[model samples]
Target chain A: MTALPPKLQDYLDDFSFITTREERADFLIDIADSFQPVPARVASKPYDEAHRVIGCESEAFVWAVERADGRLDYYFDVLNPQGLSAMAMSAILDEACSGAPLEQVANISGDVVFAFFGRDISMGKGRGLTELINAVVYHARQRL
Target chain B: MSDIKSRGYANADKLVSTDWVAAHLNDTGVRIIESNEDPLLYPSGHLPGAVEVDWVKDLNDPLRRDYLDRAGFEALAGRIGISPETTVIFYGDKSNWWATYALWVFELFGHTNAKIMDGGRLKWAEEGRELTREKPDIGPTSYTAPERDDSQVRAFRDGVLAHIEAGGQLVDVRSPGEFSGETLHMPGYPQEGAVRGGHIPGASSVPWSRAANEDGTFKNAAELRAIYLDEIGLNPEEPTIAYCRIGERSSHTWFVLTNLLGFGDVRNYDGSWTEWGNSVGLPIEK
Candidate 1:
């Protein structure tokens, strides 16, 4: 298996040390607080349906912009104001995948959702978050 | 949405408006509880003085498929600082989907002094109501809960089978795709998909969200009646069973039928399609 991006691995390592649900929730909520939606310069309202993440109830959308160095910078927006999990997953992907090697970004497993959100998440929520990850990976794989 | 009383529900007291909740925010006799499918929702920001009762973590038994027992219920009630007389008002995301689920679980322990906040979290927030990140400092109470009773509002597999055999009313609160066997689960939600792709025999199709308006509040009595009775031909006097993929959605429908529509006898088959679709020799129809 391909190695996960170093920053993502660091996040997983940090999350691994957490033992309680409250701790995990606080950590993820902090990440969610940092989430920034795609700016008007990158994409505005009425985003193209093509970029929408399928299967995500959060109404999340993703975009990948090629940088001068050829690595991709990912931007995301979750339309649902209450979709904190989607926002958190989006923030994590934007941090971990942007400017990373395409191969490493493409190989980031959807299972990392469980690592961040924990297995106790409802089936509907788990599937939606995983689909968010899949959208990012799809963008990376498309450029490969 | 109109006023709760103006909505003309058979039992208007089962639902309280956002205004009612705002007025009762400091009511010592009422406990505001937030329940949601999204775990981060409660921690991020919730109604002031509202405590979170997680559907998965707080309500369900960790080691079993069932709900918490009497002892477990007591522990939870005590932790939430609620007595039998406390009026528990539940509200959350997805049109109070998880809220009703929690309320249903509370009913298992005979916590009947409960009501759903109409329109749930979205409505409250949209109306510019205050949401707080600060958790309340609750003074725990010693709650003496009755034994978990499955007979009143719950249905087992065999009982559902008997209901179908006896020509009882069954409401399948799943999407059209799931009802028609075109999809095993709601579009894009395959994690909870069952082995089979159809619904139980002799069930009427009514997606649970139909019971709610666009603002997350429930439809008025006339609108609900047009769908559940006029459209589906459900008799209010007959014993009825409602089910969905895992019973959460059906709990919403169960609430509508029992409290809003004044159905004489209604039960939620919590096992639902996950159990019926996978069980051996169970009859299913597209």
Candidate 2:
């Protein structure tokens, strides 16, 4: 099996130790606070529908720019200001998948959302965040 | 947009504005509660002295497909430091969808002193109000809650079937796609989808979000009347039932019809499409 993105695996490892919802929430909130949206150089308002993450209620958009070494740099924007979970997931994807091996990034499972956000997230939220992951993976698969 | 009272709601007192909440932040008789679809929202930042009540964890029964029981609710009430007489003001994300839902649950246990914060968290943030990450130090109150009385404000599957048989008014507060059977669930929510699509027969399609303005506040009474009473021709005197996937969105509509428009009787079918669409032998209309 192809190895997972090292940074992503580390995050999952860190989350695996989360024994309380409060701990998980605090960690995710911090991550969301660090989230930076896609720079204007990559995209802007009224983003192309092609980059929009399907099934995301957060109205998140994803862009995968190909680096010179054939790796990919992922950038994202979640339109809903209250969509902090989406923002955190986007930040994680940007940090973990960007410039990572295309094959590894493509192989990342959408279930990583459950790992990060936990099992208790509402069904709608879980699905939307999963779709955000799928959007990033779609770009990686397109490159491969 | 205007003062909540000036918006001409049938029950103007049911909703409080952000300014009211700010003024009442330190009022011992009132408790500010935030309930949201996103669990991260409350912990990140919230109204000062506000407590977070998660719909999934606080309001729901862990083992069953139902809400928390009387004992559970009492425990939650005590945990939140609210007495029967304490006025509860609920606010949250998703246009206060989950906030109204929490209020509905509290009502089931006879906590009638509940009100919603208009425009919810979005408006509060937009208005540049203070949001703090600090969790309030609340003293636990000994709350004695009555048994949950679902007959008044809640509808079961059998109750819904009989209601439809009796030609009771129903509102399908899902997206047009879901109401029309074009989609099994709201876009991006396939996991909550059912085996069958389409709304209950004789149900009017009014997406719950229509009740709200662009800023997430409820539309003035006249605009809301145009949609529910004028467009759909629903009589305010008639009994109504509103349902969406799992009944969270419908709670918003239930609040509108029951409180805003003064509909005499309205019940939210919390089982909703998840139960109806999946249940065997149930009739569905596209």
DockQ leader: 2
Clashing pairs in 2: none
**To one decimal place, how large is model 1's interface RMSD in Å?**
0.8
Residues B66-107 of candidate 1 have per-residue lDDT tens digits of 889999999999999999999999999999999999999999
How far is B128's C-alpha from truth in model 1 (Å)?
A: 1.5
Residue B63 CA displacement from its true place in model 2, Å: 0.3
Give me the runs in candidate 2 sitting further than 4 Å from their true place. Answer: none
TM-score for candidate 2: 0.99
Question: Model 2, range B63-120, lDDT digits (tens) per residue?
Answer: 9999999999999999999999999999999899999999999999999999999999
Query: For each candidate, what's the DockQ?
Result: 0.86, 0.91
Q: How does each model score on lDDT? A: 0.94, 0.95
Candidate 2 DockQ category?
high
Q: For model 1, what share of native contacts is present? A: 0.82
Candidate 1 ranges beyond 4 A from true positions: none
